[model samples]
Target: MTNINNIQSISQILDSQSTKKSKSSGPAQGFESLLNSVLEKTQESEQGIQATELGEIPAMDFDIQTVSSIVTDKTDKLLTSLESYAYKLDDGNITLKEIEPMLEELNADAASLLEETLSLGEDDQSLIDIARSTAVTAKTEYLKFQRGDYL
Candidate 1:
């Protein structure tokens, strides 16, 4: 009976030792390999990014003269239309009702053109104020005409 009890104790000790060794050794190899693979991939990606950026060209600057000429052409057309409308109004060929819608449309177009012509970082306050005033005047005249003030 004493010999059997000693053999059972030895077996239990050996089993616990084996369990501890397996638990420690099992995850160590897998974790080391995973960490090495992640580091290698990160290094490779950084090299690729640096190479791509070095191969890229710088952007060219835009031509200001070309842009200015285009803007001048558009402004000329808008002014011509506005002048023609004014003449028609003065000659009494067109009523306020007819001119009001056209003036509103022209005002909107002129405002858009002015914004586009004035690039970023430039002030266009005066031009915008003039456009707003013209729009208000046109609206007031239209309202007056509608109320039978023109007749």
Candidate 2:
């Protein structure tokens, strides 16, 4: 499954188990436990592939280069979209229809990147904030355009 699906599954499980959200460490511990389970499942699936003569394909694991690529690619695209939006605003010749699609794309990409970046072992709060804030700004602008505020 994709990283987005994996994150959604983890989020759902964490939500269901968060009866006491004030416990602070509960969520962190739960996340670690859930991640461990996923890794174990991946290992089991890999073993099955080996039994079938696939030569034990490597299982998925968090890789910094992979995460960095995802973050950089997504954020760069979002930045491009933002620049386009600014130009459109300045020209006063662009329509909501023209920019909505790009903003929506940025929103989707940023969300996925944020989730994957968070899965990294080292907590990079600045990257996390950038992803989150950019996504939020994109959504806000999209909604504003939809509401005719940008017309």
Best by TM-score: 2
Query: Which pairs clash in model 1?
Result: none
Q: Which regions of candidate 1 deviate over 4 angstroms?
A: 1-65, 120-151
List where candidate 2 sits over 4 angstroms from the true fold: 1-64
For each candidate, give its TM-score against the true structure. 0.36, 0.48
Provide the clashing-pair count of each candidate structure.
0, 0
The true-versus-predicted C-alpha distance at residue 49 of model 1, in Å, is 48
Q: Write the per-residue lDDT of candidate 1 for residues 1-151, one digit (tens) a residue.
A: 9999999999999999988886785677799789998787768767774544335597999866654455555566666666676686787767776766776666666666666555522355555444445544544554565576656
Worst 10 residues of 1 by lDDT: 120-129
Cα deviation of 71, candidate 2, in Å: 1.2
Pull out the clashing pairs in model 2. Answer: none
lDDT of 1 at 1: 100
In the order shown, the candidates' Cα RMSDs to the true structure are: 11.2, 25.8
